[model samples]
Target: MSTISGAHIFAKKALLPDGWAENVAITVSDDGHISSMQRDTVPAGNSVGILLPAPANLHSHAFQRAMAGMSERRGQEAHDSFWTWREIMFRFLDVLTPEDIGSIAAFVQMEMLEAGYASIGEFHYLHHQPGGTPYANLAELSDRIIEAAEKTGIGLTLLPVLYQHGGCDRRPLAPGQVRFGNDPDRFAMLFELAAGTMSRLPEDAVLGVAPHSLRAVDEDGLTAAIALAGDRPLHMHLAEQVAEVEEVIAARGTRPVEWLLRNAPVSENWCLIHCTQMLPEETAALAKTGAVAGLCPITESSLGDGIFDGVRYTENDGKFGIGSDSNIRISLSEELRTLEYSQRLRDKCRASIATPEKSTGRVLFEKVALGGAQAIGRKAGALATGGFADLVALDEKAIDLEGREGDEILDAYIFAGDDRMITDVWSAGRHVVREGKHVKGDAIRAAYRKTVAALRMRL
Candidate 1:
């Protein structure tokens, strides 16, 4: 990605905070925030083309990007599902070194920028090395993540996860789970170290805390982690699978979402990832809590997780955002398209989950962008004064997008086209991607290839 010192951009048309605007001139300050705006103005000599506010990738486990196609083989487990997929993932991570994580994460972030995500909430949990022991720096892997963000120039909301036990019953961690396990005191130190490492990051960076999940954390651990987060965003996995939901119920005497609502303080500052198996009552109640549902439609579909009830969720005004959780495929269009298609498949309907006044595509994109920014705790989601200049420019020359404007353009771009339509991307005023490719695409791809090849040979 291209990193710019400062920029004055003029878009032929742009999606503004309120709605679309024509001949928009955006002034980006040296410190990387949008300082001023001028609409209906003549194009500057250095003006950019058709611009849209890029959405944030609110949830990701970057290491899994390497395992995208690796898990497609049919295994011995009959009726293979999310739990079976986890075994393969565990094996893959067993051999990953810190350097490999940094390279792989950089590649993933680079792909994200080209795919039209200007920011990422990295739900990073691969804390230690292959074994259960911590590295000398303690935050070695966390520092590697920061290095990847600095290398890629994408705005980062790093969520250092705390994984204590293996299950809701506080079972001892299995051998494969050792790397992610940490006691409350060590986790506190790691969290503080992660926060300290952020001082070297760009101004737009955020450091959030993730208490891996209800299965991995006890009441005391969750409480301690929450106190550490203060006002910053907190994230967790919730009811991603039926077995997990049942396990929570068996141990906690309630459904996973219901348990969180009853026992904890969940608000807009918290992002609950993958509410894939929630009941209708849980859906309606969770929506009213002002928390963001971090939906990973592509990954969820790939893993055979149950469909999220978008129809019920939207009717209750629930906030939601998309994530490339498994990173099997990183496509903004596919994620949003799959989200709608899942609802359609479940409801036996066409053009499902849309606002009365807006097309399905426009409504979904706007909702995700707003919710994603909120989830990542970034000053993004819109192109306006004081917002980070995280913008994506589409090539109007693409045939699918030709003669398209307004919501129709968004519809065509998302439904009819892929990332090839994206000509350039900017994150926090830095031009990191251009001509529909990351500026350092080749170098990052080379490093990722070496890492993946080595890991695959070991496996």
Candidate 2:
């Protein structure tokens, strides 16, 4: 039903089966899947520049986008860590109505579309009303999120989260966690209800499950949750902070990753978020498991979570994907830049993550795209038939990309250019962004501004 002819197309360039072509034409069916791709030269249409499959953001907390800059101030303690930042998050989350959540999610998804992210794996846990009370309709909040995704035209992977306890020992959830708390049975019900809602979304939408973190679920709860995931993607927060690692050790006699590897049926279906504190053995073991390391480099760096062991993990053939987790900054290029830059700074070497066969940015981009597609259980992350027609076009005339060609374009886009080069984006055959601006960016942002203004009054 739709066609896009471009100067060049990076078709299937994600390591699964990779290549590029010039003067390409891609057609999309009304069902939103790729209909056909032709490599021969074609008459140029209104569209220009290179086209490639856009990346899936493998992890995100959509509501946190509103709290992005608000949590940057120092607390009474001079030091800040994940725990301190969490307290700020708790405070910010206290005032969000389901409507507010929807507005904020739409705003963030719009930003994602503009910045070349076609889909987002939203690790949603903000269920229940404020004050820890259940809403009249348990799935009201989730419906709002699905509504946001529909309005923005970005593909959705709604990862309904299971968060039960406050720590590894199964202590009761704190008052602050009331909104996020649900026992296994209640969580299952919520999951089913959310799934029904997701069924109404565009074909590109999916439903996945997430256990909030190692500290938030007991062994039994985790096992049941994993079983609930079945063939769908299974995501979890793991070993993100030193204190979390210490707590898991004290409570379980092992590090979080070690315990998870031994206990859970982790395979390609799993996406372990922020394995930041793993030992070399743990890192290698995780890599061997075929699971994705759902790395949120910008958010991890912003929250002061330590850098992941990228070199050792990659060497062990690890799969990895990037995300905007907190969405404090939503640009995909910034996420990749921060990921490589973090490695560069840690090892005190330039281009420390590049493979012998590929340039640094090319390798990172390709791997993340594949891993992200796998993690979200989508047939995407490449420009090919049967894949979702999610593509991003970079402006050839952008200053940072003017002299770039081939993989250098990717390098400069990630390393030097941010969102400026992202001239257009299409999600499932829908042109959601044009000329570096989302179609709904201004209206959605204005709605978000109003929502945040009201939230400020409540805070």
Candidate 3:
């Protein structure tokens, strides 16, 4: 269904920036921003039980959703680490055509919408075909990603990634990594073409830049990427694994986080993904920089990556947001749950992220909502005038959330419930999910199933 211009949404209770409010009414302009908001108002237009500012999934590799459950078997290595799992990922992508990418991305975006994420910052790097052959159009894969966002009606932040080398030693791209390689000049052209394709999306769609990782992009390439990004969001993978830390230290005379902070102008515009292996000093320093820590808790656990020092970082006033990095799972509640649980498991403390004034769920939901918008460069993250209309509603009638008010509502919905309580989702005024289902859920699922079936046969 096409979104109605100047649509109105009323909520029985809403988690506003200041605090929870009751009987809230909001208006969305044709441009997809909240034109006005009023509290203590009568129910009008599309009414809901509970409302929240839905966060953007700040870091994602959308094509990886197809390979979710296929890599669980044990490998020859004594310990199946991120490196070993990556080999399987490389093999999986060799068979994915542009059509497969489009189908898989559409399904992933649809799932994100249903999971309560209103937008995505897709860190897209798969550029060439098998054997490292450039397609007729350089931005073919990016176009597929944009088309997927359009079909799902989810807000898009397409971060065209620049991946140059295979390791810190500046080695040639490996056979599996070749499809993601592009020299700085060629990557600039690819980024430009990708930006051109983004006009197919809504006005809220953003184009950002990512220097794939410290291992993949050299100092010069990273500088070029920062230049390309200008003032837009610039994301990078950093210090996700122990091996990666050792390699960066051996090559650059410093750890990943330390090296980047000393070398680059790290600021709020940059989002560093998976800083799961940081020293306390590095964590404190990074927090002071105002850069976003793009955490992917589920993927980190799946790959056996170490836990981030979230307590130390937050104490230093760090900004953080959650993402479905590997796309193995996309539940927003589980991401927050896994993050808080990891901290508790490490420190043997309860309510690791909760403050004296706020419960665990309230703190996590509010922090992620604001930080995610900052990381993706979206004007959202609050039920206030001038923010994008990215909203999620929960079922008050659900047993988990029944009779809950204020912070108690968030506490129960997150700790005692899951995305099942997400009854409706609006992405930039586009009401994509209603009654816990995507408007095009069936079609997206059918396409994904066919693609995965053919993919399995090929494997």
Candidate 4:
């Protein structure tokens, strides 16, 4: 099983790079890429219904999955916003050991695969112990993330984050933020160590860099991170909240997005997470830069962050993608649904994301699938020869999906049905999810349960 090579797959109907086709046959070679494709072919090997290219979740904080429902309570502040939620998150993460993080991340990855995501861009930042100390190995926490990816067979773009300060003023990291703090020099060392650790994973695994956010890293640090990242993916938080925007403006003499576009070489390789606070010009300008706007609708709504300008950005031909973010929920359908619904609610109109030629669901799925793959630097998002065989199969027999064909299948899945219709998922030719569950889910869930139980007692 060391090499899951020379596999054949058939689908009743699939969304190919050209368009939808029936009776599709795909061949995966030893290197985990689609080697060939045939249409109107006889069923061979594993057969599936309504197959499509699965998307990479472009931004995830895997450790934050454990704090899903723990920060729902209203704090003493009159308004409990992302700041308040962040405080609770900081407190919660303090108790997580490397082992705990590994287990929790594995569980999160399993859920992502079952939810129909074939890959993930883990915006990992937790790099040290509870206090302000590093482990014997600087990349201990990052290695845990890699191990989790290995266990779950999720295509991972491990982004080792560089967090330099508490805010844009370059103040020292707060007590709760201590564990994530690393100067530019220290971060360089940590990144190298993490890269060495990532070599143990499969060839498809990517090591990227993230400079936490404008509030977390300075100009020199951001430059260092970009240089360190080279041509690989580079993700960062940008204007996710009003207070954050104001803070960046106060310290940097411009808004977060404006500052980055002017100061850094923002391009297709960059993924700016949560541009929910951008002005019209900023949206149009950033769209032209070819950077992906990573949206986390569920977590943004839960945190009371403002809605993103989906219609305007799309009008400008912007690239964007979805992410589970805090991992409060891992439903790929709901993420797409929430994105479209949020646009409709903001504009007080239906089909806000739909174009003249395509349905809402079709536009959402296709755009996000392609944009997500680009953000994660994965050669996927389409059933094409030479691309990664990252695919998802839905239950065509489901009541909601009955009689659906072409784009209508995507429409029904996102609107009427949910991830429950996801029957299988393959990440880089590895059939990790089968018959609606992860292959190693039971053991992963058991470990997560024990870890959470111990964490609760400590809290």
Candidate 5:
């Protein structure tokens, strides 16, 4: 037997960078990347159903996962905007310990693996304790997130976020915001500490930096963050709310995207999350900068955030990726489906994401996979020699997927099925999911239930 868990995978049909191929055989090396591949080859292992490259969830606050469904009820305010929802999030974080976060995050990653996401870019922001003191180990919470990823076998791009001020005016950190606050001097140390935690991660794991958002970081702090991040992947939230856009415009003399394009050395290394409120000019210009727009369609709808200008962005050939932000519902198919459906609703047209030749589902899958891989700075989103072995297998036996082939398989799954159609997943050469369930799903779910139950009582 091979010393490591190196192995082979065979698919009757698999989607490659160019297009779908038949009788594909993939060789997984001990280092967790494809060593070689052959088309129209004999089965190397059990011949599976249609195989597809999975996308990285490029923006996530893993700790917010625990509070997914608790905020749906109406609050005392007549209009519960993103601000009110943020208040609820603050209250929830005040009592959370690092151990609880680890368990919650493990569950979330397992769900993502089972749902056909090969990797995650965790935009982790909660750093200190409830009382605003750093742990003896500055990377204590970062270590917990890494532990969760290790347990769940999910590829992680760990982005340690630097959150300084409370708003555009550089106000003091609010009581609920202290845990997420840090100075430039301290943030540099935190970033290094977080990077150190990745030594134990699987191959293809990445370390990145996030400046939170303009509301949380002044220009000086943002510059400091960019300097520390260097050429690594840098992600930050953009205008997800009208109030936030207005605040940025009033404070910076321009909109959020406009300011960043003019001010920051924005490039492919940057990922701007939630461009939900941008002018058409802003959209097209930002697209030309090569920064990937990190979109969370489900969470955007759930939080009442406005729709993204995806039509304009795509028309301009903009790069974009999807995320399960807030983890309200982690479904790979749902994220892409919601994205296309939103455009259809807005434009009143079918196949809004499709080229005249390519099907909508095929285009959506390829675009997200490529864009997400770029945002995370990893070798994924394709099946070829030297590519990370990240793939999802759809159950051809599924009643909904019966008799489907090629693009129709993807179209049916994205529109008709959920995770139920995903029979297996391999991330970094490990078969983490089999038979539509994560290998560690039961144990992770048990721990997650226990943690959430105790947390509910406190709430």
Candidate 6:
């Protein structure tokens, strides 16, 4: 058992139905779950700064971390959309050996820990060989990913992705997509294999299923994947671009979100990523479904995706979470800043996402934490008994946070500060980051640099 006593504890702030606290001690069992939290008392043996439950990154493609800054070169003639960028991504993945993937994933997860992300929902889809040939062991790629998480100490929610086709019409996958393609039967076997591998991870880790996108799977495939998911979390890319919206409507009878609502069983367990181009009616309807809108504002902006209707979504009580999708820029505060800034640009107002009683940062942070925790199917995002003891300690001494307290501290951190202010982080009661650095940062980064050098030679 371990005990951490702090000057202030933001226990249950994100999910206890009431928010924020101070002068609390949190206890955790040897098995990594929170045992209890005592208010207004300092336990003997440990001392710390302000503490708060860390947030889970609801969506990530860990391998993309390797290609972070390499895609910025302008193409020969014209506009570069997400589709065009995907080609570069496919080319990049063609050279990633399983060892390379494990190294890069460990590096990314280490960065996530330092940035105050306790868990990751890895939306893994790079499955087979370069030419679509299956490895002798189907689970080889996924095992590397699980190994990466285990080495890094970040809580894992591995979402093995099913990519069946290139479009909604059940069109054959393009040559570049071979590595990601899987028939429903093959996908089921992979899912079972993934589950077995997940059982070998740290006790808090979990396995989930992802149907790559509406463009990648047909109606029958989607239905089968959902049934296979059972009660586990279901995540998918949906309506991320205007082109995708148009394609879904052209192929199906409706837009992606509308088609999903009509056809799929989307409930609380689902997370629809990048719902960027939704109509007001579609947005309102989605808000009622209890599914999380997995928003990656920095990545969306970097990729030229449109702004989400945050004000309207919040007014409708829609759930949402932030992610560093591409990992091009991995700062949690930057994601929050970009999310709110994008809304402000669209709405032409300051504090567009703030409610009457809450600051913009507080509202954004709390909502995303709740939404992400729910989507990942974890008892985290709050410091409470039975919750995973995944917590972050901010450097109150940081310049931007010098005089802040309560919601103002969140405001300064999100609006002005960056990951540098995140001094320490713990995942499932294990200290993985301290003094603003991940415990394994240097070693992981050195390994990642070697992998990147090899990938660059091939790319």
Give the C-alpha miss distance for residue 57 in model 6, angstroms. 0.5
What is the C-alpha lDDT profile of model 5 across 1-459, one tens digit per residue? 011356888998899988889999988888889898899988877468888888899988898989988898878999888889989999999999998999989999998999999999999999999989999999899999999988998999999999999899899999999999999999899888887889878668899999999999999999998998898999999988999989998899998988988899999999999999988999999899999999999999998898898878989999999999999899999999999999999889999888887899988888899899999998988887898888899988899889988888889999988888998888878888888898878889999999999998888
lDDT of 1 by residue, 1-459 (tens): 333555888888888868878999988888788888999999873466679889999999998898888888888977888888899899889988898899999999999999999999999898987778899988999999999998999999999998999999899998889999899899989988988988888899999999999999999999988998887889999999999988999999999999899988999999999999898999999999999999999989888988988889889999999999999999998999999988988889988877777888888988998899999999888887998888899888899988888888889988899998999888988888878889889999999999999987888
**Top candidate when judged by lDDT against the true structure:** 3
List candidate 1 segments past 4 Å from native: 1-6
TM-score of 6: 0.95
Model 5 per-residue lDDT at 30 = 89
TM-score pick, better of 1 and 4: 4
Higher lDDT: candidate 4 or 6?
Answer: 4
Candidate 5 regions with alpha-carbon error over 4 angstroms: 1-4
**Model 5 worst lDDT window (10 residues):** 1-10
Candidate 6: where are CA atoms >4 Å away? 1-17
lDDT per residue, candidate 3, 8-45, as tens digits? Answer: 99999999988999999999999899999999999999
lDDT measured at residue 189 in model 1 versus the true structure, 0 to 100: 93
Candidate 3 structure, TM-score to reference:
0.99
TM-score of candidate 2 relative to the true fold: 0.95
**What are the Cα lDDT values of the candidates?**
0.90, 0.85, 0.94, 0.92, 0.90, 0.84
Candidate 2 C-alpha error for residue 137, in Å: 1.1
Q: For residue 271, what is the lDDT in candidate 5? A: 95
Could you report the Cα RMSD, in angstroms, for every candidate shown? 1.2, 2.6, 0.8, 0.9, 1.5, 2.5
Q: Report lDDT (Cα) of residue 247, candidate 2.
A: 94
Q: Give each model a TM-score.
A: 0.98, 0.95, 0.99, 0.99, 0.98, 0.95
RMSD of 2: 2.6
